[model samples]
Target: MITIIAAIANNHVLGKNNQLIWHLPADLKRFKLTTTGHTVIMGRKTFESLGN
Candidate 1:
């Protein structure tokens, strides 16, 4: 089973100007709870966006 989780805005925009449109705490919590210790998959741009 592939459980896909994502946040899509009303405008269907995932990002803009290299920043997240929404930085809600609940969203962060959900992401942490959902992907913790799990093998996550993302595109190159998404991976690159998360700088070290």
Candidate 2:
């Protein structure tokens, strides 16, 4: 099985100026829980946002 995760904002903006709009602790927890023990795939930009 494959699982995907992404962060979105109220204006339907995934990213702006190559950054996240807000930080939601609940969403962060959910993302961590969902991607646990799994591989995550994303664009280079997204990876850069993670400081990878």
Most accurate candidate by lDDT: 1
- Model 1 clash pairs? none
Candidate 2 — which residues are off by over 4 angstroms? none
TM-score: model 2 vs. ground truth: 0.65
Off by over 4 Å in 1: 48-52
Q: In model 2, what are the clashing residue pairs, if there are any? A: none
Per-residue alpha-carbon lDDT of candidate 2 for residues 1-52, written as tens digits (9 for 90 to 100)? 7655767777889877877778788987898788778788878887786763
Cα displacement (Å) at residue 21, model 2:
1.5
Q: Which 10-residue window of candidate 1 scores lowest in summed lDDT?
A: 43-52
- Candidate 2 residue 8 Cα shift, in angstroms, is 2.7
Global CA lDDT computed for model 1: 0.83
Model 1 per-residue lDDT tens digits across residues 1-52: 7898778799899888867788899888888788889988988777797687
Worst 10-residue lDDT window, candidate 2: 1-10
The 0-to-1 C-alpha lDDT of every candidate, in the order given, reads: 0.83, 0.77
